[model samples]
Target chain A: MPQRMARVSWRLLLLGVLFCAAGLVLTARLAQLQIVSHGHYAVQAEDEHMGMEKVFPPRGAILDRNGYPLALTLDTYDIYINRKVWQDEKLAADGAEALSSVLGRRPDEILAALGPDTDGDALVAGSIGYDAGRKIIEMGVPGVKATATIVRFHPEGDLASALQGFVGRDQTGLSGLEADLQDQLGGSAGTLYFERDSMGNPIPFGYRQLTQSEPASDVRLTIDRYIQEATEQALDAAIEKNAANGGSIIVMEPKTGAILAMASRPSFKLSQLDLADETKMELYRNRAVTDLYEPGSVMKVVTMSTAVDLSLVTPNTTYEDTGMAYVGGYAIENWDFSANGTTTMTQLLQKSLNTGAVWVGQQIGPERFYDYAKRFGFGEPTGVGLGGEAAGTVRTSEDPEWYPSDLATNSFGQGISVTPLQMITAVAAIANGGELMRPYIVADVVGPDGSDETQPQVVRRVISESTARTLTAMMNDVVEGTPSHGARVQGYHVAGKTGTSFISVPGGYAPDRVITSFVGFAPVSDPRMIVLVKIDEPQGERLGGTVAAPVFAELAPKILSYLGVPPDAPALVQQGG
Target chain B: MSALDRLIARPLPRPFPRVTGVRPVLVGAFLVVACLGLLQVAQTSSATTTGYNLQRLQDERFATQAGVHQLEAEVAVLTSIDRIDREARGRLGMVPAGTALTLEVHKQPPEQQFVPLRFLSETKAPQVKTSSWWQRLLNLLPFF
Candidate 1:
């Protein structure tokens, strides 16, 4: 009995020792995990809890010459989703429906935009206005997030829509002056590293890291609102009166080459940009610098100016007009085929005689005349800092198929194309005493502060001062003397020319179709502004002198009055003379 | 004989094992080091989060300032007097009416007593024109 009792006691002792040993091993394992491997587990946990993202900085605004806002940024918002926070399919669907209703979109469309079964983080909506975003936040939908973004807005709506252009959804300039100065207008984006609470709300006194952000410099353009309005009104009136397709007008300071106003008819509204509307897109093209046209009789001024500059002819140099001039076996007739026995060079210009222009071209020859055209900024872009500028076509002397008829046709502004800007700028060169000032709309660039930096540049001198004076005087005769008599404004001496070119059709120049234009400067002695008015394919009165000249006359007086230019002479005397 | 028996009584004691293992001292040092490291990590994380928030607030303030300036510029442009005048006159062709052409001739003699009554009438009647329609109606109720 004693031996059996001792055996039971020994087995019990062994079981107790084994249990104690297991407890010691478990404690040792706990110490190793808590002390040695703690850092690895902690890092993994932090990665799951914390997140960081980069934030874009504020972009700058575009100002007019007078520090008025043309383009600016406004605070906007975007909607996002957290897949983990969304409790059920109903909650997700309801949130999307509420957003779509406020955004004026279909539920299915919003759903499609949110994408297919996103994991945790996904962008649901973009470019929502502040008020709409606020409303969505007020609703407090689970898993939905609202993020702030910057959006561009033009307050003036359609005013200068084509000139100032518009920005895209990504805040990049897409066209017009905006596209030309994109880098200067776009600021650097900054990074934002911040810790948030479990609810994704920024906690007070929370940890954050930020990089310094540089604001974009402001671009200041020289466009005047008043002059732009006047030009637009004048062009609109002319277009309506002529029943023409469309037209363009450009006004500039003759001496400075500062473009005061540039307008095109059928202008687009910045607020109503329809991407699918090709017709509206076509109107957005600035025809003043982009589209090239046969400048018609306006080209004769260049030819006449070249002749007088080279001393090939003087104001009194006489030519006998028998109604036609033959060049390369092709006969070019004067406008209306009016035959005059003998006419002075000045008289030929006053009448816009086609044959007379051809005679001057013949005297100057193709090479010299083409060089003069290039010097006057024809057949090239003006580098006006606007997108879609055209380098007009001027036939070269070295062309394989160069013909004398090409020169003759070009002399009267046919068989060659020039943009309205080129035509008007060349005229300004004559008015501004031969100095070919580089035309620019942007006057200066302003930094974040009020400080500004500007570099005024001039292109080159195209003609001698003496030649410019002679050309001005001869053009003055055209405005005041005979053909352009109707275009003379009261109490001001005007210098201008008229053009009525037959448009090119499938076969040849369309008989009934014409593009009439009038380009002129006011107070010829010291010109303040150069104005160009054009009308395309008028239903009636195809002559520039009859249609475009009256519009010029009406616009000039108002422009002069608005500019506060006192009358240089008595009204009746200036008008009658 | 009793004294000799008491003196002869004696006793023996059990022996004990020596505690010479290093486990207790090593565990104690590891626990102390882990507590100190945890405290340092918590402090660093808290400082980083606070610094990040401060910087983000500053950036937000700057952006708001830029926005305010931009809006002010826009307001100035939209309310410019020249732009308004051009739109009114050029687009609408509105001309101001001259007083010379619009003036009407009165064919009645002045109806009032001279001196004190004239002053009272002039002062009190001018208020009638500036009042609201309801006030004017209340004033005209006496005539009915």
Candidate 2:
């Protein structure tokens, strides 16, 4: 080629300039993405190849005092269906039918949950056992994935269902101790971050950020497995024998305010519970702590205690009982609608005489009466460390509905509502030397490292020790004086009172419906345990002595012996006495 | 001097000249490259091994945790008191013990009692001789 005078072509120059400018722009854009907005882009990249998952820590176990498990967490799988693939394949088998065989679900139900046209990870089944889940995983089913989740299981079935309670699908406590101590039982969740390789498997030793989860602590309740079973069995027998609708029983260590056992009928097992059923939902509330009723003449325990503590009456104190006493234009009549001339305080408690309770209330007067009621922890919650607790209703002089007749009725546990917990706790004060204790069921919070123990809390001293002794002695006379009343326990000087109050209807009171209850303690000398048995609407025998007292009489001996307490009476009752 | 001698005289082959800077430098470069290549290979192999080991360990940890939870749940179900009672009564045809005559055991006379040997000096150290678990631990001990 000849060296010719080179002419600079403007077109070539323009093209060169355009190329340089384009390269510069590309470099600048690369810098912006890789540097200026690096964190944002890095996050996006992580979202693509990296995965983030929630790691829920294991929930704590609820144990009985003897380290027996009440409620515990188990690992179960949530079976997810790759529905998109199923729909794409129009899966050869009816998926519902296929899964129904393995899952025990109705075909129609399964189909509704896993419809043929569904997309993405649809839940096919939940809470499948580990062995079953593994089998499913090994089946290599293309359209199925199994992920583990936690489920609550009660080892003892319905033994203490209402007390232990259940957890919901979201892994949160829903009721009972489960709800009350959620923070202690439910631990903090954590996140697991990792990058995946080409096969969609997490890359080992590659860019992983893990925040460890803390396991939830375990709860140790004061409830004894044996005592709880005994109470439930006794209550069940009582309900059947009395032909009662339902009932509640509370066994407490009066000395420590520890609820050894609390049981209620119409309870459902955690495993059998179906939240969708409204009828079963009512049984979820622990009636011992939640339900309120006219506690009947059990209020006499408080009434008589008030009078005895005030030195206004003794066991031998007498009151005149006219057939019907008129107060605030209301006639107060006994159950038999008759009079027992002049009644002694001991006879009043044993007979559950309404007339005598009114006279005692009259002697105490309104000011002292209301003050004693407040002192006995009536009209307020017992603070028993349960979820649904009720404060008993009382009409004091301060309330507008105060009636002179109300005082007469309230004396015998009418025109006032109370829970089984409150009644027992009040009577427990007398059993515990008149010191009101805040009742507690949970004994300790245990963990891998250590345990946090629940101390016995005394709310306050309600009455003098001497008063408690007098009342206990007087209560003992009630059981002994009236042996046919069924309050007497063999080989023990039992101290207790019986109560039967009418259930109020729209107007006055139901002729048939009545709440019959017995509140008492055993081995009256040491007073190891106080028991409350309340039966709702006993069929034939409407009186507390007939319906409720026998329950205590039967269960007390077994309970006392089980607790290793020597009897205060003859080793064996005198036969045919 | 003889003409033959002059023809045969090869000046004693100039002693081979001493090799200096250039050749040595070239050889050094080759050696450095080889060493670097070997180091890179070792690093890559170690990383791959570490990654595989991490994966295996992670799987093992998960499996163990799952196993522990499963066992806990199983124990709870089996040890349930109601089940035990039912099995005892229904399957075994058992009954609650009736009242019985009480008996008490008194301590033996001192002459009949055998006292535990008191060792002034231990002759042998207690060791796990048969257990494989202990043997495996022994394998980890440098002194063993």
Candidate 3:
């Protein structure tokens, strides 16, 4: 009896030991599932029921100041082929033939885009018209599908093409204002989350949440359509007539510093834009803001204006011209190399004499000359609200390359570089009573919230109002006194200065190549518009007064008549009659 | 009295009732839990229905926005300056206006009024105003 009882006790003890070991193993597994790998399991569970998708909003449209669309974002379609489904020879042929008919491409071309018969997706046709894409969809071709896409379109057919820039395949701005204001032009994407079934379709009754996308702001540039067209036509005509390499023209509202029109030659047309051609990359730059050239005699306006503002010289301040001024052992002569014996400050400008300009620079000296140049927004960018702007090179006495001759050359717009924008903005300061305003391209921005108009911002006063008026009068003498200058208007007292600067080469200046430019404003009493015309290397008539001034003379009258400014010199017109 | 006789007399005095199996507190707790479960199920059903409706509306809005964009593109094309210029010159036989001739109407100038120099400038024109350094520093304060 004792033995049997002991055997039962031993068996019960063994069973208790086995049960405890199994419980410990179960507890460890439970701990791992609940605590150690909890996050992993939780994410897996969420993946079974939840889904997220990104929603893209349309890009903004670029409009002119008067609400004319220049660049627009329009919905198109991208036709794609499923390579795995197209592996079937019959389905591939049928779909390719069907797509080719609508896409205006060969069947083999479509098939080639599809690639080898494998499991992948390929874009057969991108940015096809909406009507044609819809037709392909209606045909219900096998192994093919059309997805919606947004494309950047220039509706005006290359008008302001360089200014509008272009976009990449992913709908991102690549250049110009489009690249500068990407944040404002590109709308933010949104997110959507919902419960999904095993097949990745939204459940019939699922939890859904959406964050709506913010719409892009419409950018209204200060460009005027009529003025832009006229400027382009004028530049084209000038380039063709003079057989020049290229040119740039800019029209500005002096009072507000609003850019009315900006055009550059040798630019790509929107209809014929081919990004693969690398030779045309140089044409993509907006020369008005990016290219730097010795502004030639145009810098004399700044030099003379600085002297007049400081009471160092007056328009009638007289000086002796020996046909040449020796500075730093170099002889500087007038543009024509035949100096008048006695030249007044007014005559210095009327004749565009380099020797006279050197005399005035001597009065102002280099220290104050560069300071005033900086004040006039030279040696720096105008900050015209564009990308890829060149600040321009200014060699001062402090630089290693400086010589005393640089002061004289720079006095008449040489040995220093300035973008066309800087030249025009400086002249605009004189046109608008000496207040230097920050030039702006965007006039307003209309968004989903409200409209924001860009107010004119004044940088600072570069010169006194009295000095501006005095300089304006002197410039008027330069234009009206020299009727052969080709900048005179019949019934308008136009004030202008012409520049003829030689192109600098590797070691010295190019003997025959010159970049001629004219900067002018009309109705000098109360100037309305200021224009800058720069021609590069004209075949003949290389002087600014002859080549560039005539273009301005042709464009300015049309612009003034459009603005409805009353003629200040009706008597001059009557005399002509 | 004898013990046996006393016990029998006491038993006859009262017949106690048998104890019941259920408890009132437990039953009340179970009823409250069941009601909460039902409410949760109803709420989930309502939410799922609302989500379906929202999804449908979102799709419709997307389609309508796309249509509006299409129409806008069409209008932009039709009203483009290049198109108008071409049509005006080619179809309508129009020419650019000639050099403008102005007819002078001699009239007396308007009488000038004595106005303050400050008021003489255009109100909307940008004005340059200077502030003290202290004022500029104070503007940096959040509540200033």
* Top candidate when judged by lDDT against the true structure: 3
* Order of the predicted models by TM-score, top scorer first: 3, 2, 1
* lDDT of prediction 2: 0.83
Evaluated against the true structure, the overall lDDT of model 3 is 0.87
DockQ of each: 0.04, 0.17, 0.21
TM-score of chain A of 3: 0.88
Top-scoring candidate (DockQ): 3
- Per-residue accuracy of model 2 over A392-469 as CA lDDT, tens digit each: 788898898787888888888899888888888889999999998888998998876698998998988888898899
Q: Which ten residues in a row have the lowest lDDT in candidate 1 chain B?
A: B97-106
lDDT of 1 at A54: 48
For model 1, the superposed segments whose C-alpha errors exceed 4 Å read A1-54, A80-89, A92-126, A131-140, A191-213, A276-280, A449-455, A572-577, B1-63, B66-70, B77-144
**lDDT tens digits, residue span A455-478, model 1:** 545688888899999999999999
Model 2 chain A worst lDDT window (10 residues): A1-10
Candidate 1: docking tier = incorrect
How do these models rank on lDDT, best leading? 3, 2, 1
lDDT of 3 by residue, A1-577 (tens): 9999999999998998888888988999999998999999999988887987665578998999889888888777888887878888888888888888789989899889976648767888889876777688679786677776688877777888888888776667888888887877887867778887654545656666779877789999999888998999999999999999998999999999999999987788877878899998988878889999999998899999999999999887899998999999998887778969888999889889999999999999988998898999988888888999999999887888888899999999998999988899999999999999899999988899888999998989999999999999999999988757788876888999999999999999998999999999988999999999999999978999999999999999889988888788766333321
1 or 3, greater by TM-score: 3
Query: How high is the lDDT of residue B15 in model 2?
Result: 78
Tell me the interface RMSD of every candidate, in Å. 12.2, 8.1, 4.8
